[model samples]
Target: MLEISRRGQAMPVSPFRKLAPYAELARQQGRIVYPLNIGQPDIETPPAALAAVRNADIRVLGYSHGAGTESYRHRLAAYYQRAGLPVVMEDIIVTTGGSEAILFALLTCLNPGDEIIIPEPFYGTYTAFSIAAGVNIVPVTARIDNGFALPPLANFERALTPRTRAILICNPSNPTGYVYRRAELESILGLCKAHSLYLISDEAYREFCYDAPYVSALELAGAEPNVVVVDTISKRYSACGARVGALVTLNKQVYVAAFRFAQMRVSPPGLGMLLAEAAAELPESYFDESKAEYQARRDLTVARLQAMPGVVCPRPGGAFYVLAHLPVDNTEAFGQWLLESFSYENQTLLLSPANGFYQTPGLGSQEVRLAYVINRTDLAAALDCLERALLAYPGRTEPPLTTTEVASAFTAPLLTQLQ
Candidate 1:
């Protein structure tokens, strides 16, 4: 038998993809699964973006610059400027997706066994990426009680070691949909500066804020050299398949290091560059309409979940996710039950269990992330399923369920599973 690399063994399986088997089972059961599991949006891609790719009169598809096509980079730089991040085309290195941009940052900025601090219940892929690069992930806890706000600066200070290399964050975060306030971000900036640490801001959901203003790490101009912004067209333009994202920084050293990493991957998706360039030029109303739609879904989902027994969901500031602490003893098992047996109106729902989001063990055990990617009607129905399932499902410690699960009694999951 062939032996696998130790790095492969060291890596954790992606937590989000673990639902595929259950989702397939749901489909096999002839059940309609409301997909609250993934961040894949249902918004329409701009016609102009599609037309750009379709109209390209290319005789031969050729790889462009390793940093991405010049034209696309220029447009992307302009997009950042419009979003209030000052940047030049040279400051942008287009990658296959935000996923790759993250990988590049890890490879460029961190050495093996170095640590990157992240908030608990963070983007699940961060664990995978950290492990793959042989970096240590220092997860600081942020409770669901505070709506998953950034933890106090003192908590971050407590976790720091000489091995710490960077602080990674997802603005208007995934799972929690908690947008960090300007004050919170400023505090974090001070922490990073004091520690001389790199700040990696993953703004994958930049345009999705529903309730609060976004604070970009780049906005702290003095921190420019210490901050790197990772952006993608996946969520912004609802172009997940485009595979176009950029690693942006004003830090000359970080830029050069990341440029070398980009070369190893060759050019990013060729056709995607064409489409992303067009998407960058889309009218401001594109986001306005998208924001309005997501806000409506958020409103419906929050209201419905609040009415459920043994469930407490925080209304998110932005993005499409709400991390609800279910009354269940084990979210993984409950999530499995949801896919395998539970339903309302003959429709079931899929969710990403919260355990994987936390780096520390035994945290987020009772929480599950719900992505409100569907329309209002479907979101309403999914909430109905949860409400009924909590009443009917037999996982809670208490026999009779509260109107909404008491926030205080809920526990985080014990284990993080590989997908």
Candidate 2:
């Protein structure tokens, strides 16, 4: 029989969506699901952006320039500049989504057998992309006690090997929501410069920072050649359906190479670019209102999680996610039970099991990542379900893993099981 390739066989299933079958089963049984599993926000997309698509005067929806239409790229450059990144039209390559941009960065900067280092409890897709690119990931562990701050520089230094080609970071990180400050950025920049390594900074959550000012990798002076930023309108504009994003770098060679890869995909979505251009021109007040809403949601999420017995959720500085350590022995089993067997007022909550976020095994088994994308009412209901689920879960464990235990677990060898 013909067989799937090893690469295809080794691809990991997304922990975020793997239990979707159980979620569907619950919905079919007439239960309301408070979805905290993914990052799909309920915020409205800017009216102007929607209007632009509605009023388009195109005779035919033709493919745009491979890099992106000149007009859209120019507008995007301006948007980045206004947001404090020193970007120009030439530095941008429009992508199908941030996922494509990440794949492009990995493929362009590293060859097969090359290695890239990432912080543990990162966006799970990073592992999928690295596998697709035939690249290996070396992970450094970050602590939950400190809101998953960047692992010590020494940890990064230890993970480096002769085959290391780049270091990837998600500022305002996806699973952890820990935003890196300028000092952390500089420390990583110093390492990249010293080792002549590429820095792929995924700043998809740049606009959602609640507490601290965001410092883009693009803002790192004299590190232009080393920094490649992967950004998207999905999170910023609450337009995940648009599927528009960009790979940006001041380095001419990287930009040119990425442009060539963009050519292979022909062009990004035409209508999405039009929408993104209009989004670029939205008034500052648009973000002000949106950020206020998300901040309220984040505040509610952290507070409620803190109130839950046997739950430890540190306040995340940015992004809409918080990683909470639960008293359960296995979050995967507990998550499945939440959908299949547990509910409160006929409502159950679905969460992304935190284990998938870590490259190292046995690190996140007792944790889960929650997205505060829903409104306060629904979020409160979800928290209610979670609290009850924890108390009733059969796998409940007492005295949650201490910081010392967690630190030791980080050194455990990677497990072969995907979960």
Candidate 3:
């Protein structure tokens, strides 16, 4: 028998797309399925950026420099510098996408058998990437009681083992949408500096930060040598198909190491660089409309969840996701039920089960992470399906708090934030 390598078997399947087959079946059955499962935003790519690639005068779409073309890197570096991060063209290594940049960072920063600590429920693919890098992940679980804020700095300290080589954070986090405030960023950076560990900051959602200003790890006074930022044009400009992302660091050695990995892939997509370079030139004000749109979606998702009986949803500070605690005991079953057996007016919605996002067993069993990337109409429809599904689910139970109790818990903090 041809055997699968242990590493291959060990890679965690992405929850984001694992249920795609179910979605296909629902479509086959003539049910309209709205996807709230993944972060694929329904926003159109900026016309100007698409035009850049369309108008390119290329005779041969050959390989760019492994560090990306000098022109693209220069432009991208300027975008970073304008945001108050001190960077230059030489400090970047362009890769396939933010996903590739993550792989590069993990490979470059840690040795085999090393460990990296991350807060859960993080971008779930981090586990798959760590498995590929031959590193162990020490997860500090964040809770929904306080809106999934980074598990306290003390928790990070306690999880540290001798093999721990780095700490990775997704500011304006994915599953929780809990943007790291100044105090938290500073404290986490101080801890990293004190321990001489590399800090990988995945700022892919920087531009979408709503309630608070986005802060880059690169902006910290002494973060120059210890920080590597994984950035992408995919989420920034709704250009996920472009597959253009960069690994940026002021650490000369780290940049050099990552470049070697970039070279092994030959080069990033050439046309992607063209599109990204043009996107980089877009005005800072370009984000105004898009940001507002996502914030509105976030608000809608949170309010709907909060109003539902037996549901608890804390308003997220930023990002387009809300990790809502459902009235069911296990979300995986409920999620499958949404596609397989349940429907509202011939409609179904796809869900990303929160359990897959947690590496620790038994955690997040009652949760589901919803990405409000669709338009208001589709999103509202999905939530309606969700409400009806819960009522009809065989295993549904009264959640810990009533709708009033959950709504009141969010009122004080939300009011203070607005004031």
Better of 1 and 2 by lDDT: 2
Residue range 313-375, candidate 3, lDDT tens digits: 988887789998998978888888888998878998998998878888888889999999999
Candidate 3's displacement at residue 160, Å, is 0.8
In candidate 3, how many Å is residue 284 off? Answer: 1.1
The per-residue C-alpha lDDT of model 2 at residue 347 equals: 94
How much is 414 displaced in model 3, in angstroms? 23
| TM-score versus the correct structure, for each prediction | 0.94, 0.94, 0.94
Which residue ranges in model 3 land beyond 4 Å of their true spot?
Answer: 399-419
- lDDT string for model 2 (120-188, tens) is 889999989998999999999999988899889999999999999999999999999999999999999
Q: Which number leads on lDDT?
A: 2
C-alpha-based local distance difference test score of model 3 = 0.88
Candidate 1 matches the true fold with a TM-score of 0.94
The candidate, 1 or 3, that scores higher on TM-score is: 3
Better of 1 and 2 by TM-score: 2
Predictions ranked by lDDT, top down?
Answer: 2, 3, 1
After TM-score superposition, the amount by which residue 236's alpha carbon in candidate 2 deviates from its true location, in angstroms, is 0.6
